[model samples]
Target: MIAPDPLYPVLETERLRLLCPAAPDFDAMAAYLAPGTRDFVDLPPDPESAWWSVATTIGHWHLRGYGHFAVVDRRSGEHFGLVGPWFPHGWPEPELSWQLLDGAEGRGIATEAARAVLDWLFLEKGWSSCISMIAPGNARSLALVERLGARSEGMFHHRLTGELRIWRHVARTATGRKLMEGFA
Candidate 1:
C-alpha cells in the first residue's frame, strides 16, 4: 500500500488509478521486468538493469511532461502495471505502450487503463494519433491492441526491442480543436 507521486496528474478509471512512476513502484516494476523467456522489454538481463529502467521511467515524465502511469488498484493501492503514452528515442512517433504484472493479467486492467490513457492523450492533450508496438508472439498484447480497435500498419524494427508489429490509433474527434481557439 504505497502512494504514488503527487507531483503528476493522477487519473482514475472505474477500478484503478493511474499515477506517476514514483520510487514506491520500483519493487513491483522490477518483478514485472524480471529476466525471463518473455521479451516484453529490451533491458539487459542484469539485476541492476531494473533499477535503471525504473529510473528512466521517472525521468521520462520530467522529460516528456507525460509518460507511462503506474497502474494501482483503487481499493488496495497496489501497483498492477504501467500503461500510457510513451515516446522514447528512435521511435518513429509517440506510442500507446503497456506492460502488466502477472497478477494483473486476465483481469482487464490493461484494457481499462489504456482507454483512460487514450482519452487523456487524444482528448485532453489533443494528440492527433498514436501507435502501439507489440512483441511478435505476445498474444495477450496483440489481442489487447486489437480490442482497442487499432489496425496493424506494419512491422517496425526497433533498435532495442527488435521487430514489433505496429498498431495505429487515431483520435475519433476531428483534430481536437480547442473550444477557446481564436477567441483572443
Candidate 2:
C-alpha cells in the first residue's frame, strides 16, 4: 500500500477513495480530459493541458488552503476523477464540483463521492454553504445537482469560462451524521 501523504486529506466512501492530486493521476486525467470528453468547458485538450491542470489543483491547495480531490476506485485504486470544494481567482464564492471519467459514469460514483465531499466541506470544514457552477448543456451535472437538492441561483458570467448556472447548497451539519458513519 502507498503511504498516505500528510499534506492531503484522504476522504473515503464505500467504494471510492478521494485523495490529493498526484503524479499518477495525470494519466487518468489526460486520457479523458485530453480527448475533449468533457466538452462543457473551453479547455483545449490538444496539448499537455492535463498536466498543467493537475499542477493548478496543487497550487489551489497552497493558495486557498483547500482544493478538490482525485476520486479513485477503492478496489482497483484507479484514479478516475475529481470532487470537492474549489475556488479559483474569480468573481464569486466557493464552489463544490465533481467530474468523472468515461467508464466511471452511470454508477452513482459522482453522487456518492459528492455527498462525502459536501459533508467534509460543511461539517468538517465549517462552511455555511456551497455552490456548483453548471454549464447550460451539461445535462449530467444538472441532474446530479438536483439530486443533491441544490437550487438554481441563476447564471454567473465567468471571466473566461463564460456563463454558467450557479446552484446553491446549504451546509450539512449533524443532519449529515448518517452519511459520515461508514467512511473508511
Candidate 3:
C-alpha cells in the first residue's frame, strides 16, 4: 500500500498560509469557485468536477512532487482558494495557476502564493522554468502572469482545449531565487 503524505505544512506569510488541499477543503474550494469553477478551465470542465479536482490535487503531490496549495486566511483560518503547479497526465509541461474565492479577489493572494511556489520550484526543486497558459478572454489571469514578470511566449491550440496563449518565466541565474527567498 502507498504511504500517506504528511499533513501539509503551513506556508505562513505575513498575511496568508498556503497549505495543501485536503478532503475537507473541497467544500470551501467548491464554495469559493462557485457560480462556476469549471468555466475557468480552457475547455469546458465538468460542473461536478470537484471530487476529481481534489484527487488530482493529491495526485500532484505523489506524481509531480509538488501541487496546488490551499490559500487559508491567516487569522480566521477560512479557506480562500489555491495557487500552484498543475500538470495533466501526459502533458508536456506543468502550468502555474490560481483561483481565489470571490471575497479574496483583488487582495494579491494569488500573486503571493504563486510567487512562493515559483520560488520553491526554483530554489528547492532546481527547476529552471515553468509556464502558465491563459485563455485569450481571461484578462484577470493574463494580468496576474504579467505582474509576476512572466512574458507571453506564444499562442497554440491545445488540440483538446482549443486556443491557449503560453506565458513563461525562466531563471537563468540565482537572482530570482534570492528575491523569492526574501518574500518568505
Candidate 4:
C-alpha cells in the first residue's frame, strides 16, 4: 500500500503556532465564517458549509505542497485563524492570505503569522514572489497588505468573488536577499 502523506509542517512565532487544519479546529474556523466575518469571501450561509471548508483546506495540503495554516494562540492555546499560501482553481495566482475570527483582530496576529509564512516561502521554498488578492472594500486587509510592504498591482475580476485588488509582495532588496540566504 502507498504510504500516507505526512502531516503539515508546523511553524511557530513568538506568540502563535501555525499548524495544519485538524478536525478539532472546525468549530473555531466556522465561527470565522459566520455572517459579519464572511463578507469578502463567498462563504455560504449554512453551518455545514464550514465542514466543506475544513475538508477543502486539509485537502489542499495533500494536493499542493503548501496551503493555509491554522493560527493558534500560543499562550491561550486557542484557534484564532488561518494565514498562508493559497492557490485554488481559477485563482489569478498564488496568494498570501489571512482571515481571523471576530475577537482576534487588532492584535498583530495576522501580521506575525503572515510574515513567518512569507519568510518560509521565500527562504525555504524559494518562491520569487506572491500576491494577496484583497477585496476592494476590505480596508483591514488592504491595510495589512500595506503593512507587509506589498504594493497594489491593480485589480482583477475573480471568477467567484467578483473584483479583487491584487497586492504583490515587495521584491527583495540586496539586504533582504542576504537575510533570506541566512534563513536558508
Candidate 5:
C-alpha cells in the first residue's frame, strides 16, 4: 500500500475541525451506526463493521492521497461527522460527501466542513470538479448540494447502492474565485 501524505492537513472552520480519521474515533462513529440513528448512509451494523469502515476510510488516504476527514465540534471536541473527497474502485466520479452523527444535524456543520474540504480539493489538490451522489428523497443532502452550488446533472445507478441523483459540482475559476470563495 502507498504511504499516506505525512502532511495531511487539519482543516478548520469557525465551529469545526476536520482531522484525519484515527483509531480513537471508531466508537463515536460506530454509535451512529446503531438502528434508528443510521439513515441514508449504509454502514454495517456491528462494532467489527465499524472498525472496518474506519479502517477503509483511513486506507483510502493511503491509496488515493486524499480521503474523508473526521469532523469534530470545535467547542466540545466531539467527533460529529466525516466529510471530504472520496473515490473508491469503480466509483462513477470523485465525490465530496458528508455524514453527521445524531444531534449534529440542522447546525450547518456539514456545509461549513464541506466548504473547507472543497476549497482544499480545488485550490490545493487541483481537482477540476467533483460530484455528490445523493440518494433520492434525501432532502437534506439535496439542499446542501444546492447550497454548495452543485447542479443536478442526472441520475446514476450506483454499483452498490442502486439509484442516486448525481449532482455535479460547479467549476471554479483557476484563481479559485467561485463556489468556496467565502470559505477561503
Candidate 6:
C-alpha cells in the first residue's frame, strides 16, 4: 500500500507555529471554536463539522499542494488556530486567511501569521498573487486587508460558493509588487 505524504510544517512566527494541519490536530481544531468564530467560514458550529474542517485541510495538501495551517502558540504550544493560504471551499485560486481562538484575537496574530504565510507562498511556492475574501459586515477583517495594502475592486459572487459581498482587494499596488518581486 502507498503511504501518505508527510506533512510539511512551515516556520513558526513570534507567537505562532505555522505548520501543516494533520489528523491528530482534531483536538486542536475542536479547541479553536467558540461562540461565533465560524461566522466567516460559511460552516456552522458543531463537533462533526470540526472533524470535517480538519479533514478538508488535510485534503487541501493533496489537492492544492497547500492550504490552511495549524497555528499554535510559541511559548505554551497551545493551538492558537488556523491561518494560511485558503482558497475558500471550492475556489481555484488560493487566498491568505486566518482564524484565532477567542482568547487569541486582537493581538495581531492573524496579521503576523498571514504575512508569514503570504511571504512563504510567494517566496517558497513561486505563487504570483493571493487574495482574501471578507464579508462586507466584517469590519475587522476588512481593516486588516486594507492594512496589508489590499484594495477592493468591488463585489462579485464567489464563483464556487455564490456568496455575495464586496470583495476587499485585488492586490494591485507597489507593496503588492514588492512582495511578489521579493520572491523573484
Q: Which candidate is the best by TM-score?
A: 5
In model 1, residue pairs whose N, Cα or C atoms come closer than 3 Å (at least 3 residues apart or on different chains), thus clashing, are none
Clash tally for model 6: 1
Q: Candidate 4 vs candidate 6: which has greater lDDT?
A: 4
Ranked candidates (TM-score, high to low): 5, 4, 2, 1, 3, 6
**1-184 per-residue lDDT for model 2 (tens digits):** 1225546677888898787764443354554364334541236664466556767777887777778777878898775677878898784999998867667778998998888888777766777778999999999999999998788989999778899999988764465533333322
> What are the clash counts of all predictions, listed in order?
0, 0, 0, 0, 0, 1
lDDT of 4 by residue, 7-31 (tens): 5566788998787674343354554
Clashing pairs in 3: none
Off by over 4 Å in 6: 1-7, 23-47, 88-92, 159-184
TM-score of 2: 0.78
lDDT against the true structure, each candidate = 0.75, 0.74, 0.69, 0.75, 0.76, 0.64
> Model 4: runs farther than 4 Å from truth?
1-7, 22-47, 170-174, 177-184
Residue 26 lDDT in candidate 4: 38
Question: TM-scores of all models?
Answer: 0.77, 0.78, 0.74, 0.78, 0.80, 0.73
Question: Residue-wise lDDT of candidate 3 within 1-184, one digit each (tens)?
Answer: 1113344434667677777665344353453344444443332344446656667777786676678877777798766677888898645588888877556678787887787777666666678778898988988898899988887878767678778898986654455443333222
Candidate 5 collision pairs:
none
Model 5 local distance difference test score: 0.76
Tens-digit lDDT track of model 1 for 75-136: 98766768988888999899999878656789999999998888777767778678999998
Candidate 2 Cα RMSD after full superposition onto the native fold (Å)? 5.6
Off by over 4 Å in 2: 1-6, 22-47, 176-184
